[model samples]
Target: MNYIIIKDSQQLTEVCQKARLADVVMLDTEFVRTRTYHPQLGLIQLYDGEQLVLIDPLEIDDMQAFSELLSDTSVTKVLHACGEDLEVFQHAFGCTPTPMIDTQLMAAFLGYGLSTGFAALVNDYLSVELDKSESRADWLARPLTDKQLDYAAADVFYLLPLYQQLLEQVEVKGWLEAVEQESQLLVEKRLKQVKPEQAYLSVKGAWILKPQQLAILKIIAQWRLLEAQKRDLALNFIVKEANMVEVCRNEMTSLKEMNEAGFDHREIRRHGNTLIEMVKQGQAIAESEWPAKITRLMDNPAYKQLFKLLKDEVKLASESSGLATEFLASKKQLNQFISWVWNKDRNPEQLPDVMQGWRKEIVGEALNKKMS
Candidate 1:
């Protein structure tokens, strides 16, 4: 493919200015995230039908032009499975691409299944076998290999063509707006990074812990999250959640005790003292200050039956709407809705996933009616 590699701000600015005039642009990104809190953006691919541009993020310091291009409302940006791509844009450019559509979400609406891979979509629709051998390439490395370039280019090159098909089908089914909203939700989700203090709520086995134990877990989780964010390291690379729970429950005091418990030596060495300190801080927390006890959804005596009814309603909605059940609502979203309804604290604010956006007009309203 004949593509321009934008290594300088001027080239990027020129290209983005030209792309802004285009009705639609294809977008994708290559990044490394192993052991990191945020994705290390390596490459960005763009195709505006006229020009194919590979943006070398490491080389280009000023990304203002690209940021403006993403934020441009008139020009629609097309992407495939854009959840992670949005993360890169949000972190690097501090903006989400406006007027976007995710081909993956589009596929789900068309009954292609939620988990369809880009390779499969290309092969099935465009009759192109994507070279994915370089999918795991170290994008952060300099002098990207020919295979890596080929792999990266293929990601955005055929997206417009695939999008054309998706757009046509979605429009015919009157689901274009739905797909757009779903894409925006992906962007919003990236911006909703978990706060450090609340990180313990996401840890496994946290629900069963007593309030005082939760206090310890909360402090430890907060410390881990802050440490990870500060160091740009993955949470588990610092200390596993299971280990945190065990340490809190057993009340291990010394580094020697943690080592004897088979804790990872590197983690013990790096964060052992901090972890011990966090336990002490947590124990000092008063009863009023302890985090609220977590109520596991599955613990409800009527959970299975209620879940089955909701799922059955989803099946009916799917058949009626000619959409995938998974597309309508995932198990987690359903659980969220159940939780929101069950909690006495439930109100209009921070509605469950199913009860938001286009879903409200489709299945969410009916689900609410059923719950009522």
Candidate 2:
């Protein structure tokens, strides 16, 4: 198990040069993010057709060449379950690899499974049992062990072979373009930053708040977003959602009031006044400016029956089209569809993926027929 460790400008330059000439390469990253808003990149693993290398971002001074290769349009970037890896690459190089192939998505496209792991894919395709001992290694440590190196290398080493097979199969099924479109959209979303004003929508239990309380929740949530980004801290590190919701619900106006509202956090003591100020500003907002109360579809017997019918339609479509049921529409997506049809005001663009693209042709028509 031999591989090169690229820790300097010259080694990186050579790797980038070789990568540009290659038609496709496997990519993976190691990072730690338990304490921060963004994962701290520790290692990047790459596999050209013949060589495997690990790039140590902690030791490398310049990454421009590698970044260029990532953004290079001609080279196909191969990865597995790339949601978090795409984020890591965006943060590390301020760019995302394009013309990508996500083996996980490809597997789903082939009706294998919705969220297949890399090890499972390897076992299914190549009969290799991937070693999992170093999967949880502390990659940020100064010296990554040989076992860790082997594990990391194995992540990308099998990807190229997997990609070749998947490409041929998808092309035979006439699904190559559809798969690429889905992966491209997924990468673009992972690379985009969430807007502070829209951050409240991500807070848990937000839908339970009344219109005015939701206004306060929005203000506090937005402030938490900005503070988290500024300090490179997790949102909960600044203020937990429970405490933020409590403050907004009770209209806590001071540090003493925060305690009275049952919000107890050590970090809150440091920023209690700011939280109160945000609540006060939110309260000052005119009634007309308050957001409308979120309308959730009730779990009534009648609506439940409709949801069941929709699921039946999805299953029928999956069987007819020979696509994975999970890929066509998950239970979660079905619930979203019910909410949109019942509420009538939810954004059409935010509708489930089944309602658009190739999925619409396969499953959405059946579901829509049931609705009518």
Candidate 3:
């Protein structure tokens, strides 16, 4: 395999120009982000048939040319599980690749099980085994080892053939449009960042909290998010949600109380005072000023019944299709569907927008059948 290490913007631009002439470009990125909410991009690997180029973002200042190439409508970007990689590009280069094809999603759509890891896919489709041992290698380390380079090259090298195989399967299955639509939406979705205030909605314990506690959790979560971004560290490193929930429920104010509960003092030592202040501020807020009460979906019997039916439908569809149910629809989407079904005021005509494309074709029919 001919590998080109892109050390600066000029090389990156030239390589991208060469890649743009190709019909499809196999793309993969090596990033480290265990320390922060956002990933730190270390190496970007691109392959266009003849050459594999590895771009060192640390040395490259002007990524505009590469960004434009990514956004080029003429070329297709082939990747496996590229959502996070797309997010990295959007964050760093201010653009997301257009006309992208995610093999992970395509695999599922083509009746391959969901959440298929890269190594497994390569082994299955290309019959070429990959080394998973170096998955956690420090990409930021200087003087890349031969093994690391081989691993990186392997990612894009087999991707070209895999993409072709998946594309053929999708076309033969008459799901090319559906898969393409989903892939485009994935790129669009990755470009937008969720607001910090709405971040609390995703916390596992939010549903159990009372309105006031939910409000306080929201504020504290937002503060913690900002702090993490500023310090460039993981959110859990600052304060795990489990610990935060405990603090909120117990109303712990002092570091001594927090430590007594088995919370690591060393981790929170620097942010301890700020965390305390946040808690104090949360406690001081008027009860009426808290967020509106969140109604529990499971409380409604009809909704619960619909939720059960949806799960069964998903299971049946997944089994018949040879895809994973979790990949087809998430538990959150199940809940949302239940709510949508129970809401008499929601027009079925508008349902397509909320639940569109392949999902509509697969589960929508069953939903309509049940509702009717």
Superposing all C-alpha atoms, what RMSD in Å does each candidate have to the true structure?
A: 1.4, 2.2, 2.6
The residue-by-residue lDDT of candidate 3 on 1-372, one tens digit each, is: 778788988788888888889989999999887777778888898999977988888888898888988889999998999989987887788777788889998898866766788888888988888887777899888887989988898899888998888889889988788888889878876776668888777766767777777767878888878777788878898788888877777666888888888888675686667767877888888988887656678877677677777788888878776667876777866766656666634456745422677777777677667666
Scanning candidate 2 in windows of ten residues, the lowest lDDT window is: 294-303
TM-score of each: 0.96, 0.93, 0.91
- Per residue, candidate 1 scores C-alpha lDDT tens digits across 1-372 of 788788999999999999999999999999999989889999999999989989999999899999999999999999888888888888888888898888999998888898899999999999999878888889999999888887888898899899998789889998888887788888877689898879999999888788888999988888889888899988898899888988888777799989998999997998889888888888899999988888888988999999998999998899998888988988988998998899844578979878888888779988888888
Top-TM-score structure, candidate number? 1
**Count of clashes, each model:** 0, 0, 2
Ten-residue stretch with the least lDDT total in model 3:
345-354
Model 3, C-alpha of 17: deviation from truth (Å): 1.1
Better of 1 and 2 by lDDT: 1
Order the candidates by lDDT, highest first — what do you get?
A: 1, 2, 3
Q: Write the per-residue lDDT of candidate 2 for residues 1-372, one digit (tens) a residue.
A: 578999998899999899889999899998888889888898999998877999999998999988999989999999999999998888778888887889888888888887889999888888899987887778899888888888999898888888888888999998888788789868876777788888887787887889899899988888899988899898888998888888877788878877766666675678898887889899999999998886555545677778877888888888987888878888877877776666665467676666777887888767866776
Query: lDDT of all the models against the reference?
Result: 0.89, 0.85, 0.80
Error of 3 at 298 (Å): 3.6
Better of 1 and 3 by lDDT: 1
Candidate 3 Cα errors over 4 Å, as ranges? 299-304, 319-324, 342-354, 369-372
* Model 1 / residue 61 / CA error / Å: 2.3
